[model samples]
Target: MPAVFILLRSLVIRLLSSRLAGSVAQFLRRTISTGAAHIGTALRHVWERIRSQESKEAVLGCVLCILNMHKKVET
Candidate 1:
């Protein structure tokens, strides 16, 4: 019947939309976690260098390198 077909179609659409949304959310979570890890590692490295008597210029260079790497990743 037409009514049955319409009901089935709507159900399929709802299922597909929900699945798509879940996939997108998972992807975003992964991206956020990876970016956070990169930032943490960069900061830790910089901090260690500073504590070990590295020059200010050297620390600045390290920060710039990390930022450049991030720019490359974004593209």
Candidate 2:
């Protein structure tokens, strides 16, 4: 029946929209946490290197190298 079909379609759309919203929320949360972890790691590494008397130039070079590598991978 037309009424039954319409009801089914509406239910399906609602279900799918809810699922998509959930997926997007999960992706955003994961992205934010991953970014935070990376920043924390970089800060810790820099602090440790500085404390260990590593050369500033060498640390800067390493950081630049990492950024370049990330850029390449992203592309």
Candidate 3:
């Protein structure tokens, strides 16, 4: 019936808008923070490698590795 259809639509809207649907902000914050922490650690490791007494070729290689990881373009 039309009335049943309207009731179902309203119920779906209410459920989607309610707090029981869960916090999108919380999910975003958690995902971003976790991803940022990983990137921070990776950068730290690369920085330490640069600061160490490694050869110039090795340091350049590390940086090149990072760039290539994202895009495989001819150097």
Clashes of each: 0, 0, 0
lDDT tens digits, residues 15-54, model 1? 9999999999999999999999998898777677665455
TM-score of 2: 0.57
Could you tell me how far off, in angstroms, the CA of residue 65 lies in candidate 3 after the best superposition?
A: 18
How do the predictions measure up, each by TM-score?
0.65, 0.57, 0.44
Q: lDDT of model 3 at residue 48? A: 70
For model 3, residues 9-36, the per-residue Cα lDDT tens digits are: 9999998887554788778889999998
Candidate closer to the true structure by TM-score (higher is better), 1 or 3: 1
Q: For model 2, which pairs clash?
A: none
lDDT of each: 0.85, 0.85, 0.79
Query: Tens digits of per-residue lDDT for model 2 on 1-75?
Result: 999999999999999999999999999999999998999798788767585445776777776788788554545
Ten-residue region with minimum lDDT total, candidate 3: 48-57
Model 3 spans with C-alpha error above 4 angstroms? 1-22, 52-75
